[model samples]
Target: MATVTKPEGTIATTRKAEAEGDQLVTMRGIDWQGYLTILDMKTDRRFPRVVFLDGEVSFMSPSPTHEFLNDRLRSFLRAVLSGLGIPFLPLGSTTFRREERRGGVEGGQTYYLVNRGHVRDKKRIDLSVDPPPDLAVEIVVTHPADDTLEVYRRLRVPEVWVCTETELVFLVLDRNGHYARTDSSVALPGISAAEIHSWITRGGYDDEGAWDHDLRRWIAEVLSPRLRETTR
Candidate 1:
């Protein structure tokens, strides 16, 4: 049950879906200014995540299960990166928008690993001047109305991980400026979607200390060695 007030003079066609406490509403023909107006109005609240693409806007209210999965994935990723000793800046649910491209999105868990140095000192990210996040993660408990991947593509985000109740997908932006599915992450080097999926599933029910211990051990004894050899 999420609501958005339509901006004046915009031809808005609405579509809504609700399941398991998740709600999505898509409005077509919303101008860029209208999108900004909506975002400005909702500055105080965090729910009803919004995305805009080519005059269309989608507002999504994530369910409890959706948020639970998001937290699990974030924790798993942080552990992996920490165990690997990679310096990364995590920007949770940051809204990225490029007015020129007419695209904008709020990432579930965005990270800056390769470009961490470039933006580390900055307080805000302006997509027109700043580099896009190296990696963006999306948790899909309920499907959004717009093509969010396309929005990321337009934003030129290098890598995107899409996680669901049963699947995890890795998409790397290729030279052709399109996202292509890959097994291993280009940003995280040796980490694979399958490995992350396995960890996320296990971490959901396992004790936190036990899960962290096992994951750290695996990274130290197995993944770390593999990465070192590859670099050599």
Candidate 2:
């Protein structure tokens, strides 16, 4: 049973399963942010061991904060995605459930990689999947690594937003595997990144009720009038 604190950014875990080797999936413990999974690039998705969170034990689940934040972001994104005619799954913590999603599964567990087989740089990450997410959101709280932005770039998540207690910064993954801020949201059209960032940093960060209501209201206001009709 081995565990490590959540890293702010992506940290290479020492453990890497051999090619075509059998991976022993075990659940030892759970971290607040979530856990990771290490998958064999070859075959047998079930065998790629899942570390952190219930550690070899599948009964237990993530903590309250993890569950709540996951739900909140997913719920919001699900709505926005639909409005923009984008297809996506919540895949918050469950993103680690799949073998290919277990890039950093062993040692550094809080953050999980999107796709495993197509890895470009060991130190610099460039994650890719057959069907990549249009966007991803991470509620950045407290963690070790000072550079959390690297994960989004490495994962090649297309567009990402990191919501801290203070602000929400949006980054768009480009052709060169770097991120840049944009006025319009690639995933959520009509959703202003600057306004959302400002709202997240305000005094209402702690109160979920107030924060959500305000966010929804803002979304409704900015979206096409036809959407408001359906939302109502």
Candidate 3:
């Protein structure tokens, strides 16, 4: 299992499958350059995001339901960050690859919290030079062949949120450099995965405006004081 330490690049595991929509194709023995070519050709940037791992490649197309849930979750997180005065840089569906790890992943939504200050003025992210996003999100309307969490773990992302229609799971990277299921986020304190799941499930927002209003209000009236007292 060769892991990319600096994003140099491809792998050799192969699996194939077909579907009515959002097709998935996995194969091994693909060099880093081959994977790069495949990625370069896709201009539309539609569904079926790609993942590359040690000698294997996976192409996945997410469904509309997946997109809807992904959008809602992304918005919810940004609102929370803004309301709480937590600086963050949202990296939406950015393709991240590292040749050294022999794996790469494009998160449904990714964010740089600890490194937000560094990327504030940048026009784009250069993973070779910069740390990977602290948090990556996945909405599992359809499952992929390669393990998503494993890919992130190779990328060294601090946190991952895996959301199914029924449940949301948080995986935090431990000191030993592996993911462990946790109730609360290590990357974003004062918020738990269950709480987020509940809010999305409740779904009272008439529109984005309403969602923002309510989220900010909740933070200001409820979470703020709690966080302040805890810090004191």
Candidate 4:
């Protein structure tokens, strides 16, 4: 396979376009090692997420709306987990790479549940030695060249939630090591993708703080029985 690496500082040049909307750049021939080098270079700046699959690399700079939904959904997920009394560790946009699989990805919000406590204190995750997150959240106002679902599949991610302005796509990895679109999350039982969409895209909230307050109230009353009992 050909190896092509993007020169440093390319991401900095896209600020103008990023100001208008999301900017995406896809490059080919970058090996796994090259991906790691670029990742280290941008360790401190994580806005433009980098994805690596085989020799293809994609850098995605999310738009303001994308960021808004990303953060909103992230906060909502945490509220749901906490209300349900489930322990979780939020690893937002953490680059997870495995050279052996020649796959790497950074979700808008990624999280570990079953193994959250195990790696709670660690600062970095080595997928070669550590377990991958149970679920990854991807917000797609625009799509990219490389298939993120394919990347997640190759990385053996258990579940992925792909959200758009109009739709929420739920995917679960099957026993065959492939992702299949589903109606509900297998990782987050009783939570359908549509339900999450309804909550996230609810209208008439004057501000995010108000929305969050209403969301938490709804989650307590309608989503979690234990939370409802405690509140009552």
| Candidate No. with top lDDT | 1
- Candidate 1 per-residue lDDT over residues 1-232, each given as its tens digit: 2244455776679898867667898889787777888888885567788889988888888888788778778887888788888889998888899989989987778999988888887888998889999999988876752378899999999999998888899899999999999988887777777778888777454466777778788888999899999999
- Per residue, candidate 4 scores C-alpha lDDT tens digits across 56-152 of 7788888888887888788889888888888888888887878888888887788999988767888888887788889999888866423677788
lDDT (Cα) of model 1: 0.83
Estimate, for each residue in 1-232, the C-alpha lDDT of model 2 and write its tens digit: 3344344544323332232222222333333334432232315432222333322222112334434544565556655555555544443332322224332321111222333333323333323424344455655443312223453344445777765555556668878888877766666655566555555444636667777677667566666565556667
* Per-model TM values vs. the true structure: 0.88, 0.47, 0.83, 0.85
Residue 17 error for model 3, in Å? Answer: 5.3
Error of 2 at 192 (Å): 1.8
* Model 3: worst 10 consecutive residues (lDDT sum): 1-10
Give model 2 RMSD, 1 decimal.
12.4
Candidate 1 residue-wise lDDT at 116: 89
Supply candidate 2's per-residue lDDT for 31: 38
Off by over 4 Å in 4: 1-20, 226-232
- Per residue, candidate 3 scores C-alpha lDDT tens digits across 164-184 of 889888889999999888977
Worst 10 residues of 4 by lDDT: 10-19
Better of 2 and 4 by TM-score: 4
Measured on C-alpha atoms, candidate 4 has an lDDT of: 0.78
